[model samples]
Target: MFDQRKQDSLAAWHKLATQAQQWMDPEQQYDELLKAADEMEEKGLITSSEWRQLVRDAGSVFTGSQEHKTH
Candidate 1:
């Protein structure tokens, strides 16, 4: 059971990371990352805890992008 969950978490992270690299715009990437995380969770690809971690990580990463902030 723990092994299965570990696999799921790794898969989720890889998928989300790949999607994250598709967009150069931080805001758009953040939006799409959240959407992907939602889809992954809905499809049982990830646990809710994993989804929340992905959200928090993405938020912190993208939120720090220079392009995302207004001068």
Candidate 2:
């Protein structure tokens, strides 16, 4: 029925919104950013120089003197 489909769509949207909210959390944001950086490096999206700069910039945002430790 139309009503049922609408309800299902709403539920799916709500779940996605919740997931988006979780991804917005600070820790999650950091993790996701690191993942993206790693992926970029692996896919050759950024040169080593660019990646180092990105890491330095991102490290500055975090607390502690340790630099961003990439795998």
Candidate 3:
């Protein structure tokens, strides 16, 4: 079973992701995600690998938003 800290981490990440999706500015969203990921990793809420994955996923969001903007 996952511990409290692990559960808290998942909850935090889920909240962040949901909020990021609602932002009108993709750059701002991506930046926020990176910042949050850094904070989470520093607090040991997420692993380095998870941080990398978050960054990669943020890039995808940024790119997709840009494409929509150009269309």
Candidate 4:
């Protein structure tokens, strides 16, 4: 009975780990960051100009534009 329960726990752990790995995908992370930025803008945490800059920077990160990337 103990061995069976251990096996079940291990299987469940593997499933959760797999899901976590998938959830950390780079594109997914970028989208999530954009959504968070939107929420911040809605909450008035940042100005309109700042939000625009955030979107532009995020796009540059994925698109690999050196102009936007450099200081």
Off by over 4 Å in 1: 1-23, 67-71
Provide the TM-score for each candidate, comma-separated. Answer: 0.61, 0.47, 0.73, 0.52
Query: What is the TM-score of candidate 3?
Result: 0.73
Candidate 4 has what TM-score?
A: 0.52
| Pairs of residues clashing in candidate 4 | none
Better-scoring candidate (TM-score), 1 or 3: 3
Please identify which of the two predictions, 3 or 4, would achieve the higher lDDT against the true structure: 3
RMSD per model, one decimal? 4.1, 13.2, 2.6, 14.5
- What is the alpha-carbon lDDT of model 3 when measured against the actual structure? 0.75
Best candidate per TM-score, number? 3
> lDDT tens string, model 4, 1-71?
65575455444433433343345654654565577557656766667887787667556544543342464
In model 3, the clashing pairs are: none
Model 2 agreement with the true structure over 1-71: per-residue lDDT tens digits: 65575455445433433353444644554455455556556766566776676555445433222243332
State each model's CA lDDT, in order: 0.72, 0.49, 0.75, 0.54
Stretches of candidate 4 exceeding 4 Å from the true structure: 1-23, 65-71
Candidate 4, residue 34: Cα displacement in angstroms equals 0.7
- The 10 consecutive residues of candidate 2 with the worst lDDT sum are 62-71
Each candidate structure's count of clashing pairs: 0, 0, 0, 0
